[model samples]
Target: MVMGGKSALQQSAERHLWMNFSQLGYYARGKKLPVMVRGEGCYVWDEHGKRYLDGLSSLFCVNIGHGRADVAQAGADQGKQLEYFPTWSAAHPPAIRLAERIASLAPGDLNRVFFTSGGSESVDSAIKLARQYHRVTGNALKTKIIARDIAYHGTTMGALALTGIDSIKEPFAPLLPGGIHVPNTSVYRLPPDRTADSLAEAVKRRIEIEGPDTVAAVILEPVQTAGGCYMPPPGYFARVREICDEHNVLMISDEVICAWGRLGEWFGCERFGYIPDIITTAKGLTSAYAPMGAVIARDAVAEPFLNGDTSFLHGFTFAGHPMSAAIALANIDVFEREDLLDHVRHNQDGFRAMLESLRDIPIVGDVRGTGYFHAVELVRDQDTKEPFSPEDQVSLLGYLSDELQERGLIFRADDRGGPVVQLAPPLIAGPAQFNEMEELLRPVLHKASELFPHAR
Candidate 1:
């Protein structure tokens, strides 16, 4: 067996397969094709037999870690008992059970559970639901959605329109109409005089500018992800709620990345002490054991859509698949049994401290994250807080990421957060894993900074 040889399968994949959400030119050149063969616990083995820690949890999924036989068995058992069913007219037991459990865990009047295949589907579903809810309540003209800049809702046509990043939307021009943009609560990028009230005013101004009567809902992540793991400032949600109430616009807390122990809480909105009309989540719901996502609606968001001939008119074929539902139930069981939430609460300080220790490195400008999710923002200036230029970021940061990987750590070299190195280990990770992460990063980052010709 030649090392990483071009099997016909691999060769065909290179020539024919169109990969999702990637820079295809780079892929075609065969620079780095990391073929992850197997995973056990918090680590994975690549094709070359190199084992690296899955610090990013395989794109923030895989919450239960790899190789959970119980979850696999659940899927198999569901496949045998009921291979397929639709929730249109009839529902399966697993779906029903999981929905009730999720409803129980959710806060306030968010009692309805609408299932989808994944986060994007769930998000796409939520938008349609919001539109219908407004139409039913005699706010027929209120079909517009307001999402924050740099926020990512989903990639489906409906969901993509609500996504705030123009870069993603630019390629797919002339998407769904009435989707608007608002200023996000990324305090990291908050203006010099930006107050919570002022930011809220900025949001309110967008709604007003678009004519509040046309707006149906405002969607946001509890913590913005694509903008590079930005945390919400204190009083941000409170002010937003006030603005939403004033505008009669439904507020959506997109907990897709922040829910299920990622942020040391059940939901970020809960931690922030506010109630959103809808909460969308995925990624960790089943610990990524099975593909599953959910859109939860408050009583008000659901009640209107329930009566009459009007329906949300949206659902995925695999939505609430029995196998995924059962696996999710088991994943939740594991969370409770292991007391993972409490674990996150207790150990996050050590995580914070460990990451803050990296601030001494010249390239590390700011290290900000919450609970288990964190990122080290790399920069040029240690004092004035300047970022590396784009070209330097490409060469230096790119080189550093590979070096860190070679040293046996796996995290994100995130350009989404404006030249950051994202560190989001599993919730099960504790002081031991934290120490290992620091060990891998400290020297590698120092070396990377010195290697940069642009280094101050």
Candidate 2:
């Protein structure tokens, strides 16, 4: 019953589901967890009904796939009209019409939207609104925070001290301090004569050795998704927005998994033209059904809390939850009635030519990413690019994540920084879900390059 029939409330959710970031001692030893239940356009069906192919959208945040009955009837008519409220200091009407429709779909002059309850409280409320908008505009020694190397940017405690993945912040050791880190646009793992203007002058030499009025923000991620889908190079975020506008620093774009429409713009620094001063989104706004997130800023960083009493004193008790802002204004009305950011910018070049035709297999060394957020990268020496020897990256990412979820093709077989696989799918994923994800990723990456074999 638990496997296929899966009833009895799905076997009581493996005894009281504590699931975030899994491995709960393999579901407290019994090991069932694979539930899933249902979904539709773009598939999902587990609890043994099997099916799949939500690919990474379930994590990358559903963009507008999976049985979206008009975003669950606009969160069931805002839970029968205002199910909950609290943008604290009172505000409703679906969080003031979804914060005036995410400040008219965010971009330059971002127009202040706050809210949070996901993407690590919109990256710890845009690093406490960039250190209280530089201490109410007089730069009380800014307050440090750059990010890149293996960048993840979430988990809590000031976005886990701006998380750059030192083994997931080394067992959460004394975090939430200034938290700096760098070098990540990953010219396939840097080093060889580093470029991208020396990684944007290593963020202007780590904000001139953390002395540009004690640097208050830099946080990136136009792509760098969990540090593998990496991207950003060509004039890297226009040289980190000219090194945070010649060091007045406050870039902060985080876009929690590259904003809505996954990567075919609608943010992701407007497909790398660059315009930061804080963005921090959530997994495709309300595409994750309801839980929401935001931050947005830039009316010159909310003009020192728009004058008067000076209040940016952070918030969240389900920040802006009028049924997650009426399921984020009915998920931006299904992303403007299924334009889904121009259908992932007209099928992201056939999903980057079907992940660059898996670069002639042999451990698909580096396909990289752009839209529909790619990855691939596996190498053992695709002519000496040579990665994957952390015990063959946990036995070729646990055998291509259990043979591509037993051949139904759900993605993300990550290794945090190295071995890859990721994919984004579901912005109404096309070309027949990229030919059923390259026919379930080419024979499971051709049997994971023959059980992780490579070099001559």
Best by lDDT: 1
Q: 1-456, model 2: which lDDT tens digit per residue?
A: 435544656467656867677776765565445678899988899866889888788888888888888778877887887688677778878888888788888887888788888888888888888888898888988989888777888888888887887887788789878989988887877787786668878889988987999999889888888757878778888878887898888888888778887888778888878788889888788878877888888888888787788998878788888887888788888888878888888888998898888788877878888778888888887877878779978888888887788778888877887788888887888898898899988888887788777875
Please provide TM-scores, in order, for all candidate models, with all chains considered together: 0.95, 0.39
Tens digit of lDDT per residue, candidate 1, span 315-337?
Answer: 88888999899899888898889
Candidate 1 off by > 4 Å: 3-12, 453-455
lDDT of 1: 0.83
